[model samples]
Target chain A: MTTDTIVTAAMLAIGDELLSGRTKDKNIGHLADLLTISGIDLKEVRIVADDEEAIVAALNGLRGQYDYVFTSGGIGPTHDDITADAVSRAFGVECIHDPDAMTLLGDMYARRNMDFTEARRRMARMPNGSTHIPNAVSTAPGFVIGNVHVMAGVPQVFQAMLEAVLPTLKTGATVLSRSVQSPFGEGDIGGPLGDVQKAHPQTSIGSYPKFDGTSFSTELVIRARDETILAAAEADVRAMLEGIAASRRT
Target chain B: MTTDTIVTAAMLAIGDELLSGRTKDKNIGHLADLLTISGIDLKEVRIVADDEEAIVAALNGLRGQYDYVFTSGGIGPTHDDITADAVSRAFGVECIHDPDAMTLLGDMYARRNMDFTEARRRMARMPNGSTHIPNAVSTAPGFVIGNVHVMAGVPQVFQAMLEAVLPTLKTGATVLSRSVQSPFGEGDIGGPLGDVQKAHPQTSIGSYPKFDGTSFSTELVIRARDETILAAAEADVRAMLEGIAASRRT
Candidate 1:
């Protein structure tokens, strides 16, 4: 892995269930953490419905902009599962039944005495010239076409697929962060925080406020690819918080 | 409210915390449900970092494609909270401190014997020609410019702002859905499911699979604006599930 390479990734979460508010998404955060630790920056995320045009457009929009594009959901053996076809359309490639995928799924179903119907056979199809992404939880495999990786939407299956794919890619410098909180409200700390941000332009500072019905508080987090810069920003934030506290006391 | 009108919306979730995986968003689901009930369709959702260019690009991309664009996060009294400025840039407008927002926040702080510091005054800023979306939980108000609505990132404050804004907007016919689950896997029901989908092109049919380590199952959901079409598609799905179950029993 090149140390200078700033690897970036985007996620396409495909499902109507997500848009309908029936299922809360758990994959975005999981994949975000995975990518962050692997030294790949998660740049953007788009959640689209299971529709073909929506999937194709989002796939096309993201795949070219980022180094890697990971998609979760819509690979199941159902009519609504149009991810594979949409991916094929996005890349202008033909989707075919890969022999390896067929063998893995066919044999597994045979062992279970389950009929591998035509709908089940859809699992074996992938964009032409793509490789299979193994699924340990279930025998059905995900596939990678170009830089876009298609994976399951199920939380457990998505995690397993991410693990399977992570090691194969080259990683860069890991982004690190430090968090600090104060009873001081965001308004109380905003001015000094801006000064802190200007002093450390390399680090990104975020202030999140929390209200417990009676009082407001803020948690400030500083992040950077360099540990030294991250630490320096953290120190400045701490000093600012202390200054705010002192003013409140006096 | 027009029954035939198709109301569409896009969401821009602006925060480094979201892209960094430090925060699990709870506002998307809440807004999705709110939009569904209000007869507006949430067509797309984008989670972007706190960076100015990224937010501006996403804001422009989504705001044009959908009828309404709702933004969450970054509207706070903090240095990293750049959402108001970003929105102003997206709309080619000036961001200035609004007297209405200042009065509300100023009085609230005065009641608590807290000084309305410069940092706190930042919360009163909004894009020019915008209207305020009152926040009941916190004194800081969200604002709307053009078709774009900017709200807080905190769950409580975001929800309160949404409630205040929703009632003022025009709504369309509600998109309704019905769901059913079966122990039969998706592959077991896929063929007939396709036929069902073909029979009801106006309604969207989705098939979601579940695995419990021992067996596979599927949940099917059908949705449409017209209740009659939605009900008819649901019947087709239920019959398909029953046929698969009967075959399994025999």
Candidate 2:
């Protein structure tokens, strides 16, 4: 859905594996970065158990509230796979064995010289009327129903599907950023840094402090819609850091 | 916060560093697991820019919707940090230097025999009338206000603070789970799998398919409050996989 203003999107990552710490979610961050660059506001994110109600609830909450809803996980041939069914329930569609998806599965398996078992065929199940979103790195494809974009949870597959899907997404004005780093500790730099931020009200400047055991470093990042304002803030931050470092040395 | 039925929580991860990919967010998954195990349902999570409005908007949303709100990050002695101010605004409370937090921070720095900068002293700020949540990790303690529990974003500190704060919460029945793995792809099992699920209404069965270069390996997880029901569902899953694999071998 194309929007003149910011397009908000929600993310639903489903799996017990993630909560069990067996898997760290890489897809959300990738989407956050990708959507940020594309100018889509990622408004809300939820991670739920593989329970059908949980999936459906998350889907219902996300679907129409934002321009797009992205769901990852539970679209596989194994027993825990329930996302397609949940989506079917959420959208009130039949969990049909789509012929198009089946053909793709059949072609891929035949090319690989493998027997297409019923378990293998499960990958073709989609909510009726949903369009397939191709996976560049894997054979099993992702799909879209209404605003909910359902994809695999596997990092490689998720990323490939994201690349495939992003090109077609109706985007917004991109959020751009720049940064300046300092060797000084944030404690010695916070107030002056706050002043720098207060002075540049249009451009948002954020301070991040890091410790490397023996020494400290802080990064001041300036972000805005306007490139010129962002650049000006970056220079101001650099000047502050240099002045502080020089004063500290003396 | 104690409720007879349930305690819901939301996680707020603040850091421009995380958004920039300079630092990986390690606390989100940890907090999710800990809350799940404690029988506290983690309903929502947010990662925000270090801007005050962003933090305030997220804080207000979680505080209003959930039984308890847990925030991590931006409570440190740094200029980029503004969660305390944001939270104060959300709560409509004056954020004067909190006496107890000040005492703890001062003592911690005094023990190290180091000079505490104005930024270091900034860690003393807390919303008016909040209760101090003990920090056994580094001693720059967190605080609790109403249903909101503000903790450090560092994994170790955040975890330690969560453990300390969890006892103050009212818990619900613990969630239990079990898993079964199969060699066949998901398609071979969908039809019968749906039937088996229809038979066992109490047990929630989740199917996850893994794309293993040449073949698909799927894992069926059966979850329920009743172990007997879960085991029965597991037995049915085993039989389903056997039927699929046998057919594949032919």
Candidate 3:
């Protein structure tokens, strides 16, 4: 990929708990932040149930569209943890018990004096021809098949797996952003801000409205890959806010 | 919809800020919880950037697949706030400043001694034949056209809009759930849990692993619509855990 080539990614959070509201997702934001800083744009995110068909459909849809697809949840040893099988089906590959994963998990269980039960052995399963993503917190490793990086549903394990996988993927130019806080509300600055955004076509300008009980304020953010372009857009945004502030004085 | 019929829904979270990780989303979980209690199954969730084409595509896709579609964000006055237009395009309708919304916003602005400028007036833009979803926090109303309910991006306002719109929709049977904490880890219980799940095909059983820095434990949740069925499944799960504990003691 070229230097300016945007490395885009999508996230697939697979779990019935998420859709059922039993578990609030922390992975989406965490992954988005990590991917952004790594110079990979997180373009889309889908949260689906633990159903195999849903997981397969979402994985296929995302893996084809983005450079990388990171998935969390549905990788445990339980019956509902079917992400590995779903991913295998998505790629038309056989879901198998890999020897490396089996050995790693067996060793961990032995060290802890555990029985390495069939349920625990279930963690050794992965799609054929996939690489293991070592989990530092728990020894049951996640796997990488095609462009999809499957990780654990547990936050600690998911984060650790991401850390292990991130360094290996190709990245793009890190996007730089500048925030300009407007004392006035979004309604107050929307017109001029739109003009400023149009003037700076290369940059993406977003206007966020904030409510602090008593009144409303706006936070304007300008994002771009080029520092010079970001700075130029920042100046225009600052000037626009100043113009609004001056008019309010009159 | 019939009484026993399941009412399903999908959430579309729109904004560039969300995708950029500049804004961590709180709306998806909030909506999921609300929908769950209302007996509406939140089947899927998709978060996309503030692009018109992307917004239109997501809206159309979600609106077709689910009984109800809720969208939050990008209804502000700025240029990037293109959700209304996107919704209009999704429905193939004209996006216009509704007369009622214009008057409502105009009256509120006048009462607050603020000008209903062109920027603020942008809040009135919605699909031509849509009904307003009132915002108690901010006077700028969201709108509902066809099965799609579009709300503000700000958490406070989005919640307010959801409250207004939720009461007006049809709901299904409330799903009842029971949680049983296991003294053992997920690896210890995964096998028995799988057996329990197989025996009780009506109930959806989920095993969630929890790590508290020192050790891992599991929380097993059983969900179903019938109270008697739920209780039966709960009993089985409890018995399974007790059996595991007895075996460990021996």
Among these predictions, the greatest TM-score belongs to 3
Over A66-156, each residue of candidate 3 has an lDDT whose tens digit, in order, gives 9999999988889999988999999999999999999998998899899999899889999999999989998889999888899998898
Docking class of 3: high
fnat, candidate 1?
0.80
Candidate 3 C-alpha error for residue A136, in Å: 0.7
Error of 2 at A53 (Å): 5.3
Q: So what's the TM-score on candidate 1? A: 0.97
Give the residue spans of candidate 1 off by over 4 A: A1-3, B1-3
Task: Count clashing residue pairs per candidate.
Answer: 0, 17, 0
Residue B183, model 2: Cα distance from true site in angstroms: 2.5
Candidate 1 lDDT over A167-199, as tens digits, reads 998788898888898788787788889999999
Measured with C-alpha atoms, the lDDT of residue B68 in candidate 1 is 93
- Give candidate 2's whole-model lDDT: 0.78
Comparing candidate 1 with candidate 2, which one achieves the higher TM-score?
1
Evaluated on chain A only, model 1 obtains a TM-score of: 0.97
Residue range A112-218, candidate 2, lDDT tens digits:
78768775677888899999999876677889999889999987788889988898888776767887777776776887888888888877676665655444567
Residue A231 displacement (Å), model 2? 3.2
Q: Against the true structure, what is model 1's DockQ?
A: 0.82
